[model samples]
Each structure stands twice: as C-alpha cells, then as structure tokens.
Target: MPIDPMLYETQFFGFTPQTCMLRIYIAFQDYLFEVMVAVEKVILKKAGALSAVQVRGSTEAFLRFMKQRFDRLFVKMERALLRLVLSVPPTVLLPEDRSHERHPQSREDFRLLQQDVERLQGRYKAELGARRALLAELEVQKAVRAQLRKTLRWLDGLGDAHGPPGLGEMMSLLIQHSGRLRSITEDVAQKSSGGGME
Candidate 1:
C-alpha cells in the first residue's frame, strides 16, 4: 500500500500545524537557556581567575582569555539558534506542498506562524539592544563611582585651616549627584522596558 502525505502530516504535525510549530519554538527556547547556563559557568570560572593575577602581563592574559571565550561562545550560540530555527518543520514547509493544503485553514495558520516568528525576532533584537545599553550604563556608573571616591578622598585631605566643608554640606552635594545618577538609571530602565518593536 502507498503512504499518504496527508495522513503523515496529520499524524506528526498535529491537526493544527501552528500548535506543532509553537511546541518546536518552545523546545528551542528551552534548549537555548540550557546552552546559556553552560556558557555562563565557563565565563564565571574565567572571571574567578582574574582575582588571582598579580602581574600586569598575567592580568592582560586573563582579560584576553575572557574576551576570546566570550567571542567563541557567542558565535556558537548564534549558530545553534540559527540551526534550531531553520530545522523547525513549519519554517521548512513549502507553500505549494499539497499535504499542507489538505486543510483549508493552513493559510491562516501559516500567517499566524509568520507573525509569531516576527514577534520572536523583534523580542530577541530588543533584548540584545537593552543588554548592550545596560552594560554601557554600568561602565559609566563604575567610572563615576571611582571619580566620586577620589573627590571624597581629596576633600578629606583638606585641613581645618581651609575650613573644610561641614559633613552636612558634603553629604548634600553627594546626595544631589546621587539623585542625578538615579534619574539616569531610571531613564535607561524605562527605555529598555518600553522600546520593543511594534
């Protein structure tokens, strides 16, 4: 007896093809999380080695190693995700496939599938942008903190002859600067949360 493509499709892709596609998408997401966790462990281990480096050359070597590790991990992650996305049955489904046309609802189902793929892509791009912004903001905050500490140290060196500012005055200035920093932080957070593609 000959095999029927429609029967095979119904049996494997489910009555509603979209449901099967969503199941595959969710599975890929779960696999991505696992890969990320594994990469993070390796990154953390590299980060730990940084603290023990006393020499400048050793410190530079560790930094280079960390960067290389991250670069390789990112490349591997991209390839893996691309493979998973491409391997999805719906992604490979042909518009002219007669088996897919067995159900009159297939067109609408494919439209919905396209929309979901677009949404997921937009979300992934937005997340990547947000993370980059956050990292830049954190770097700025770290520099600002170092400068604040230096200023405080310099203030402490000023003797009473200069009638060093009262503790209250110093604290008031610090509070003003802190408020500005907090405002910038909040703005970044808000933009990241609301800047998703429509």
Candidate 2:
C-alpha cells in the first residue's frame, strides 16, 4: 500500500526534508560514548531523524582504530547506498547518473574507441546518402512513368476509335513527351549535382 500524501503532510516535516540529525562518538582512554544532535527541532520537521558520528580517541590503540576503522566502513556504506539507490524503482530520493558511467581504459583503448565510432558514423552517413539518392531517383521514375502512361492512354484511345495514329498525331504526341522528358532530365541532373532533393 502507498502512504497517503495528506497523512505524510500532517505527520512528517512540512514539505521539505532537509532537516537531519547527527550522532557523534567520542573515545577517551578505554571508553567510548555517543552524542545525538536533533536538527529537525530547529527546522520544523517533526518525525524521523538521521545520524552520523565522528570517532575520536585519546589512547594510541583507540586513536589508530578511529583513524583506520572507518575507511573500509565508508567505502562499504557508499557501495551499499549506491546499490540501494540503483535498485529502487527510482523516485525523487534518487537521481540516476548515466552520463559519466565509465569503464577502465588505457589511452590505446580510448583511441581505438574513437576510431571505431568515427568509422561507424562514416558508414551510416554513406548508407543514408545512398538511401536518399535512391528515393529521389524513385520519385523521378514515378513522375516519368505517370507521364508515359498518359501518353500511352491517349495513343490507345486513338487506336480504339479509329486506327494507328498518323504523322500529325505522332508529332503532337512527341511534343508532349518531349516537355515531360525535359522536366525529368532536369530533375535527375539537379539531384546528381547535389541540389536539394526534389
């Protein structure tokens, strides 16, 4: 079950959750003690608290423990925090950092990665250019086909109504096709010369 927002609003700190608590540890001779500080009391957050402690020691052995013990502990704590954060069906409590995720690499590895990336981009662009050129040619072919079909239909109508077309009719047909041919040639040439795809 999900916790109610209104219930949280009434029960927990106001809207912001910045207020926290800290627990400090002190060691003297052979004894150790802890102190807790409540920051929420001053900040208006009423429920829940956070705690962290700094260990200090007077004896040589205790001082060494204070200095040496926490390094591994800190590393473990950070790793645990990271795992907990990444595992959560993430919410505002955690922010994902995808940009800086890095793998161990040598200079040669990095150089090879760059080269591979550039090669891939080059191939992709070449394929893309070829695809665009093919599409343009297809469009040109379609227009030419449509023009040819119109001329063919006209010739078929003439043959159906009477017989095979004569000199005058053929001349008119050629004139019409010539205009369409010229347009088709211009379109092909423009595309070949790197003009805008039409």
Candidate 3:
C-alpha cells in the first residue's frame, strides 16, 4: 500500500503497484474460496445426513450472496486497476523491480494468508479425526443393535419350529404340573392319617 503507483510506474517497466494490489485482491478471493471449501467438507463430514443437507442448503444460499458480492467487487477493482495499468506507459521491468515483489505490505499480507491456510488445515484434520471416531461409534452401535435383534428373534423362536407357545400350551403345562402335585399331596395326607383304609 505504501508503494505509490506513480513511483512504481516510473521505476519499473512492467510491474506496477496496481498489479500488486490486484494480486492481493486475488489472494483474498482465493482465501474465501478455500475457506468455503473447507467449511463445506467439514459440515458434510461432521453432520448427520438430514442436518448436513439442511446445512448445505443454507450454506449454499449464503455462499451465493458472498460470491455475488465478491464477484462485483472484483470486477470493479479489476476494471479500475486495468485502466490504470493501461494508461501507464509500458516499461521493461528492472531487476530492482523484481525485489519489489517482496514489498513489506505484500509480504505481511501473504504471511497472514499462509497462517489462515494453516489454521484451516488444522481444523480440517481435527474434523476428519472426529468423523472417524463418530463412524466407529456408529458401527459399534449398529453391531450391538444387530446382535440384540438377532437375540430377540432367537428368543421369539423358542418352543417349537412351528411357532411359539400360545395360551393353550401354557394352560396345559400348568394343568399337568398341578395334577402331579395334587396326587402327591393326597398321598402324603393318607400317610399322615395312619394309612388304614378309610
């Protein structure tokens, strides 16, 4: 920003301050795109299916607005920068002008850009790790549910191959047990009554 456009034009042939500013603008645009991509991937990976769809829909709408706004800004900036570049007489860039590419402001901007990339990369890595854990937990739950279902089905299949016992079957079992118990109780009573023919 400190680089005066007129100063650069007089000093450098091809490289202009406006060109550097354009590149900075381009970097900002690229940064936004990168962030959007990372956000989309994280949302898709982290959210449930229904929530992900909803989130994606809303995010897409927001992204459309952002894209439109940035696109307009870019077009305007490009037009102005290009006009300035064209008005300036074309000159051959010197070796010194090449060093100007590392201008302090540009260097600081690029440094911040790099930091942003690194930060986003870290977020993506963490999201992927969390997703893996979530998937593993889901798999375990699915396996447990499958086992439970199988056990329930096996329990339901107990008794006979034809079908489970009905009320009639339960009543029959109860009657048979009661009949034996009754006979034993009567026998015991007869013995306690001295076992003589009564």
Candidate 4:
C-alpha cells in the first residue's frame, strides 16, 4: 500500500504519548534507519518533558500534539524517500548503445583501410593511362598500314608502266618493310588484348 497517508494509529484504550513515541522510534530504527536521525531532530527532541505535560494535561490536547508530531515526521520522511526515488544514479547514462563507439584500434584500422583503397585507385588510374597509350599506338600502326597499302598500289602502277631503272628494287624493299609493319601491328594487337584492361 502507498505509505504516505498511513500515520501512526493506536487504540484509545491504555493510549499514552510515551507509548506512541516509543512505537515511532522502534519503527524508525527498523524500516528507516537514517530517517530515525530526522525523527530524533524533528519529533523526539524535548519529548520527555512534552510527554510528562501531556500525561498531566487533558487527553484531547495530548492527542492533538501527538498527531502534529506524527504529521511533521511523516512529511520529512516522505521528502527523504521521494528524493531517494526520483534522484538519478551517478552511473546512469543516456544513449546506452555502444555499437558505434570509436576506440583507437578501430580508428587505426579505418585509416589503414582508407590508405589501401587510395593505393588501389592510384594503380587503377595508372593501368587506364597505359591502356590509352596502347590504343593510341594501335591507331598509329593502322595509319601506317593504310599508308603502306597506298604505296604498294602506287608501286604496282609503276610496274605496269615499266618506269625507272631501280623501281623494282624499290618496290621489293617497300614490300618487305610492309610485311614487318604488319607483323609489328599484330604483335601490338596481341599485347593489347592480353593485357587486363577492357
């Protein structure tokens, strides 16, 4: 049960202020050890003389005085209990999830991972540049092949006309050079294909 409204209760038969105070003291010692300190300060101070006067005085006056004392003690105890209940513990914290907590090891690992990624990016760029250079070389070889075909056609025309004294030797030399250029073009094409670039 909620204990706020539960003040000290005793039957009127053989009721006395000494009995009531003793009951309160015993209760304090049992359930509220520290609250007993407050009780001594609040209720039990000057209690001996107060109880003597109540014993000689009217029973109604004694009842009123005892009720006032109980009320004051209860109020103090309630405040102490409420402060205890409502107070936050020192270790308690908001945002208890620690999955993303950054320790030194994790941070170092992240830095190393970033470096590896950057190294891979640099290698990829270098490979791309090499591929572009190879493609340019292939284009140059194609142009050379086209030029050699035109020259062979011109040499054939010259042969039909039987022009010039060294014309056949020049034509033979041109054909041999054309064959070497074709072989070089095939080698470059094969190298480009064998390389891993797309």
Per-prediction TM-score: 0.31, 0.35, 0.31, 0.34
Q: Looking at candidate 1, what is the lDDT of residue 170? A: 69
After superposition, the stretches of candidate 3 with alpha carbons farther than 4 Å from their true spots are 1-105, 161-198
lDDT of 4 by residue, 1-198 (tens): 554321121122234434444566667545543544455545435566566344444444644576578678876765564345433344543343233343335778899999999999999999889889877777766676676677668757865686553867777867877787677667657755654333
lDDT of 2 at 20: 15
In model 4, the Cα lDDT at residue 169 comes to 79
* Distance from true location, Cα of 106 in model 3, Å: 2.7
Please give, for residues 1-198, the per-residue lDDT of candidate 2 as tens digits. 752233332233333111111111113212322211223232234433432221111233454575566555655654464345323333222122333244457889899999999999999999899888878777766676676677668756865786677889878877877786677667656655653444
RMSD of 4: 21.0
Residue 88 alpha-carbon offset, candidate 3, angstroms:
20
Kindly give the stretch of ten consecutive residues in candidate 2 with the minimal lDDT sum. 16-25
Which scores higher on lDDT, 3 or 4? 3
lDDT of 1 by residue, 9-68 (tens): 455444534344446556765665566556555655767655433344454565567657
- Those runs of model 2 whose alpha carbons end farther than 4 Å from true positions after fitting are 1-104, 162-198
Could you say which candidate leads in TM-score? Answer: 2
Task: Estimate the lDDT of model 2.
Answer: 0.51
Instruction: Sort the candidates on lDDT, descending order.
Output: 3, 1, 4, 2
